[model samples]
Target: MDASSDRELPSTQEDLEIRAVSAERLTFFGDAVVAIALTLLALELPVPEGSTNSEMWHSATSHRDSYLAFMISFVVIAAHWRAHHRVFRHVTATNSRLTSFTMYWLLTLVITPFATDVIGGHGAFQFRFVFYAVVQSAACLLFLLMVREIPRDGLARPGTAPEIFSRSIHRAGMVALGFLISIPVSLVTRWAYVCWIVVPLVDSVIDARKGRTARQSSQD
Candidate 1:
């Protein structure tokens, strides 16, 4: 009984394949949780209240902050799901660490709707902004861990392109850095949103420079 219990990890390629099926089931579970989170986000949206068209238009304008927050959260969650899908596609096995990291990642996703509400609130601008940023940054970093785990633990499929993992890591890191940088900026000004928008453009520039350097090195 002790020897059988000690054998926690799969010992053969067949066992790895079997575990891959279980990992895929976990991915499906994650998809459902993400869908539920999105639903919760939409349900929290405030309806424009009015008796007439003009009044309704005015009410909508008044609730613009909530509308804007919903849109932002929607996009952020969708992007995270997309990245999650990409990472899990190459995954061929899993370990306890990967499972734990995935659950934590999902927890962040589930909290995003509440964070959106906080962002839409009227007072304590800096505190609310920083809180939202922190949630997003944690989500990004946790996802980076998930991405790294696949390769680190030999969880990815054979013949999978290495660039897939590298690209995901870089993007997650850039996004996390953007949110972290915005936290301090939020202390001084509401313009901190500029950080999230600009960081991707900066990442693109860096990638282009690296590609050029690589090509030149090959030529030399």
Candidate 2:
């Protein structure tokens, strides 16, 4: 009989309680999107439409550099996404400024495949290298922005483990610097990807140590 009852419940506290829904969903979608993008690169991998092993090998060899670059890009994106995931894990809410920053990061993430395609053989343009550098730098800046957002939202207070996360972020910033450096380095080395390899390996060491420490700390 009450008009309030007839009006139906407005958006409930449950919805308000989950203020970080957009941030969570963005990270989730980013995980899937980067995954799909990486998988799609495999399709770009040269597969001879022929049956002869010689032809397949030859065709594949012609694409060997491209394939290698694709793999490198995959590693870079995976590392970036890994760092991004943990950064967002402590986030509890999102605002328009942070949302805009994510949009730019996503834009760079989405463009990686196109950059991979361009990175074919040893003949890719320096501009492509520049584009790659700039995109990665942008992602690094966004990563820093996300860290700053934590306190504003009263989410993850600055602490030891969070300091570990901060250290990981600092390493990512180094990778971004490496990416930028590779452009000029490519001016000398045919295998610029050789330098990029350091990113994943470094990320692995950092992540593995973190995982082990986390597991041990939990057990204790």
What does candidate 1's lDDT look like per residue over 97-176, in tens digits?
Answer: 99999999999999999999999989899999999999999999999999998898888888999899999999999999
Q: Give candidate 1's error at residue 18 in angstroms.
A: 2.3
Candidate 2: clashing pairs of residues: none
**Candidate 1, residue 218: lDDT:** 100
Residue 44, model 1, lDDT: 98
lDDT of 2 by residue, 29-134 (tens): 7788778777776777665554788877887787787887688778778877888776777665677777777777777777777777776646556766666667
**What value does the lDDT take at residue 113 in candidate 1?**
97
TM values, all candidates: 0.90, 0.73
Report the alpha-carbon TM-score of model 1 versus the true structure.
0.90
